[model samples]
Target: MQQVKAVVARAKGQPVEVTTINVPDPGPGEAVVKIQACGVCHTDLHYREGGINADFPFLLGHEASGVVEAVGDDVTSVAPGDFVVLNWRAVCGQCRACERGEPQYCFATHNATQKMTLAEGDDAGTELSPALGIGAFAEKTLVAAGQCTKVDPSARPAAVGLLGCGVMAGIGAAINTGAVGRGRSVAVIGCGGVGVAAIAGSALAGASPIIAVDIDAGKLETAKALGATHTVDSSTTDPVEAIKEICAQTYAGAEGADVVIEAVGRPETWKQAFYARDLAGTVVLVGVPTPDMTVPELPLIDVFGRGGALKSSWYGDCLPSRDFPMLVDLYQQGRLDLDAFVTEEIGIDDVEAAFAKMHDGGVLRSVVIL
Candidate 1:
């Protein structure tokens, strides 16, 4: 075991602390990673607020990139000195989803079998529940060997680390789940990190008339920089109408976009996405909702009349092994502006301040460089 400085959320609604924790050496099928960069995401904030569960003293931060330091006797996929992006979905290939050649939808994902523990103060020896099983806001962390996906070493760690979560979800929502393609019309509702990423992915895929909808004008501007052809301020205007008008202009006689992505995870916005797609279009929901939230009521006849698919995206339905390296290469080639998502670089001790800045419209991501 080794002690390292890490960020820990000891109780709900309390400030996070930078303290020491014990990371055990890799066991069978596990590996130890020396974290280089980790992004501050809303999900970490959710874990701090007890929104994920009652698992207090949670080790936060998941979107991370690192170098392999050590591996168990059975490990081979990655090795010491390899640069990697850590992922939560370490697939078990024997699962039914994998058997069907869809490991992206693998029902059984896993993390390290051994636990990291609090190494000091009153909470000494307490086992920590890692956020998404990746507790990466630290100098080092142990995880399942499969969680580490090898990527180009030359890629910037701060930029590519985001692929472990939100960015991947947004891009996947477009390219994979929505099947956005050349000349397709697309509308994205949100303009947050994930929403803007969807816009970028659509642009990369040659989608036309990419409409960005958000309440904040600043976020909409960021969306445009990332690839949105048009912007909609939904707080003052009707997004559905705007999307329809925009798509109709691009594709003759089209009622709306070919694909509508709901990235806000709100009922009203989701409703807008539901109605903002053309006939036989696709609606992909990549935003996460709270437990108390229920599905919005809509006419069953409307669902029948839509003649399209309504799908929820889980981690953008991505397979890290296949997608991470490809994306890193794209980033290296300057085709993907992965760096734009990083608003600022901060120290591990500044996580609380970063969390406070999460609501700022100008800030897309605050990355912690360890």
Candidate 2:
């Protein structure tokens, strides 16, 4: 094991301390990544707050872009020195989902066999829990070689890393699950990192008159910049009514949107998505909610009456090996405005503060440049 500086969250709701941790070299099917940048995400905060699980001394940070430093035996996909975006799903190909030809929903994903550790107290601690199977808050981390999706090195790590998670989720919701097409009237709620990306994706797919809904005006402006054609401030006015008004202008005779996306996971917003779609239109839920959260109680008849699909998108239905490099090239060609996602560059030590800022939705993404 090699000693390296890493951000370690020792306890729940406590600040993460930068401490020395032991990182092991890659074993078979694994690779060591020298992280250049990692974006702070809400799930990391949830992990630290003991909301996701009871795994203590959690090694936080997941969304990251890095360079492969070394590869283990039998690895062929990537080599050392390759710039990449790290993914959680290193599809095993033997899983039921993979056998069914849906590798995007790969049932068996992999992580590093070796665990990183720290000397926290009197003992030399081992088996630190890596968030989303990638502890990117460190200078270096170990992950399954398949997780290392090689991308263009020209694109900024801080910016491209955001695409590994939130951005990809939003884009996939629009392009993949929702099937938003040319001249479609799409509306997205939340206007956060994911929502803006959906708007951008809809634009890229040639969807017309994309409507953005949010509680914050600043976020609405960001949505517009990301390609939203219309904006609705849900804080002052009812979002359901606002969306209907916007959709009326483009989607004539339809009661609601042609494609309504709910990027907010709360029951209230979800209900809005349920009621705010055109007949036979799609509703994609890209936002994640707690286990305690439940959908609104409704009659079984209403479900059948909806006449459309209610789908949840995981990682934007993105197959890391298939999507990452293509998107990286898009960013390099200046077709994808990934640079706009990077609001600020921070140190690993500032992760706790970044978590606090996440609540106000103050930043698109705060990237930790290691």
Candidate 3:
């Protein structure tokens, strides 16, 4: 067993604590990773607030980049010393989703079979539920071998690690799910990390007249740097009307954009996305919603009248094997400004503080560097 420092949420609605935990040796299909850096994602906060589930003391951290330190004898996909990013979707090839050739929607993902427990405390023997199958806010973590996606070692850990979750979801929303292309008019609502990343993805795909909508001017400014052609302060302006007016310039007579991405998980914003797109346009919802939240009732005829796709993007429908390395290379070449996502580099002890900053919108991403 290996003793490591990890962040844990001991109870619902409580702050996370950094404590010592026990990590077991790799078993069949498992590996141990020495975490280099991990991004503080909103999902981690959700897990702590009991928004995910009631499993506590939960180990909270997922968007991470690390180096493989050991591997089980049966693991052939990755070995020790490989630089990698941890992904929650470790596809089980036998699942129906994989059998049908869409591993991206794999119904069964892999996780460590053995549990990691508290090292020394009243809860010393308690098994901790790792958030999103990866408790990465630690010095080292144990995970399924397939969870490790090998990438170029030269890539900066703090920036590349964001690709493991939120960034990937945003980028995927525009590229994979929305299928944004050259000269396509696109609008992204709610310009947080995910929203800004969506703008970046749209730019990378060569989308023109990219409109970014958000209440915060700071985030909108960041979006512009990332490649947004215009910004809308949604708090004062009607985003739907703004999007339609801006996109109309591209279409000459059209009323809306070819694609509208909703990165904020709220029923109201969803309604905006639904009405903000041009006829036969796509609407991709990448933001997560709470169970209590329900879609506001809309006419069935309107749904049929839309005549386009309305889809939810799960982790951007990304296949890590195809995306991680390529995005990293883009970042390395200075084409993609992944580094701009990192607003600050914090230590493990400051995760709670980072969480506060995220809640207040004071930073884009506060990475925990080990």
Residue-level lDDT tens digits of model 1 in 197-260: 9999999999998999999999999999999999999999999999999998888889889999
Ranking by TM-score: 1, 3, 2
Q: Cα-based RMSD of the predictions, in order? A: 0.7, 1.2, 0.8
Candidate 2, which ten residues in sequence have the lowest lDDT sum? 118-127
After superposing candidate 2 on the true structure, give the runs of residues whose Cα lies further than 4 Å from its correct spot: none
- How do the candidates rank by lDDT, highest first? 1, 3, 2
- Estimate, for each residue in 1-370, the C-alpha lDDT of model 2 and write its tens digit: 6788888887888877888888888999999999999999887888889888888888888999999999998899999999999999899999899999999999889988888888566546767999999999999999999889988888889988987788888888999889999978899998888889999889888997798999899999999998999898887888778777778877677778888889988888988887888878788999888899998986788778878889998889989888877777887888888888888999988988998899888898999999
Off by over 4 Å in 1: none
Per-residue lDDT tens digits for candidate 3, residues 155-200, read: 9999999999999999999999999999799999989999999999
Estimate the overall C-alpha local distance difference test score of candidate 2: 0.88
* Per-residue lDDT value at 112 in model 3: 95
Using all chains and alpha carbons, the TM-scores for the candidates as numbered come to 0.99, 0.97, 0.99
Residue 200, model 1: lDDT of 95
The residue pairs in collision within model 3 are none
Clashes of each: 0, 0, 0
Candidate 1 vs 2: which has more lDDT: 1
